[model samples]
Target: MKNPCVAHRGWSSRAPENTMAAIRLALADPLIEWIEIDVHLSKDHVPMVIHDYTLRRTTDGKGDVKKKTAAELAALDAGNWFSQKYQGEHIPTLAQVIKESVGHCKLNIELKTDGIRYPLIEQKVLECIQAYQAESEVVITSFHEGTLYRMKRLCSQIRTGIIIDGWRNSLPKELKELGADFLSISYSKLNKERVELLKNAGIQIMAWTINEKRAIRKIAALDPELLICTNYPERWHELRAESMELEVVNRKK
Candidate 1:
């Protein structure tokens, strides 16, 4: 199967990661078929686009993200950390993301677990998906096993991917039992033998945070069904050609 090239944190290189500008940049790229973004809840139980527990690093703020209300987070500058050109960009809501992404491109929402209020996050996320009728184009993923499990129970329609940062032989039995749609593991930890084994079992494998061309080539050779890459969305066409060329060379051998 042709692997889907997903933009990690949107086209993070073009704009601040997980912001409206980033989403716009990614959707404008024809080669980008899907985008992966992070989500977390604010003090008011509103789900917003962000990757960290604290806002100090990514935004012009200095506290835990969960401690701030949506209005407070909105007041901070989310873009200046990337570039001064976008100094006052506000954190986007899950509803805004869903609305904009509805028919444009597939979305992979990575639920951030640090300081999480599970029920609130799940409720807000599911509500946004329902509001936009985006169930067909959305997949929920998380590093938190509990979050993924709860998602599967709450909404079986949307696909679920368990994010693993380690190298383990046995796929989490709970993920399999809960009917997860796929497994997303770090590219550094995967082996070709395991890739083949998973493929043979009809389980989908998606490698995360792949950005380098060399790593892209290596993963393409393993032939996973999807690649969740960062910044590499800009080189989508070049990498795809590389994948095709590798296939031809393998066939001739």
Candidate 2:
């Protein structure tokens, strides 16, 4: 199967990461089968789509995102830092994202709770997914192994993945114990051998945030099931077209 391209935080390279603008842009791209987004629970237990735990970086607001209610978060300007064209874009709720993207593309929701804990976050996320009837269209991932475990226990039908920055010697074993469906790793840490190992163990691999042509070619050669990229789904489409052309030429020769 041709590797699918997942737009990281929507078409984040062009729009404010995690804003509705980016999500809409990614959904419009036929090449983007999956849109990956980060989520943090607001004080009111609403799942707001934003990368950092703090609002200072991505929004006009200052302080921890947990301190703000969903309504307050909804009013913050999430797009001005990226460019003037996106001046008033607001952070979207998970429900809003799912409603917009259900039939258009799959969602890869990363639970951003590495250092902090949001009690019952897994349940809240699941409720949103169930409400939208998007069970088949969503994959929940996290660096927190405990969260994945809790997610599986809560809903065995939900597909889950583990996100890692670097190679882990015990990943295969942990995945089996955790019942994880796949592994999403930093593209810089991937190699053919590692890919083969995971594939042999019946685990799917996804490489993230890769944009350079050379890096894309290298990772593409490994044939990961998903290639997560920011702002450049077209580049992967181009590479796939070239690969198909090469195959056709070889057959003719």
Best by lDDT: 2
Give one clash count per candidate, in the order shown.
0, 0
lDDT of 1 by residue, 1-253 (tens): 2567888888887889999989988898776788888998889988899988889888989989889999998888999999999888889998888898889898889998832454578778888898889988988888877887777678888788888887666774555776785777898888888777666656677787888877776776677465656666756568777768888999999
| Per-model TM values vs. the true structure | 0.90, 0.94
Model 2 misplacement above 4 A: 224-226
- For residues 93-155, what per-residue lDDT tens digits would candidate 2 score against the true structure? 999999999988999999988635797689899999999899999889999998998988899
The lDDT per prediction is: 0.81, 0.87
Clashes of 1: 0
Give me the displacement of residue 162 in model 2, in angstroms: 0.9
Error of 1 at 158 (Å): 1.9
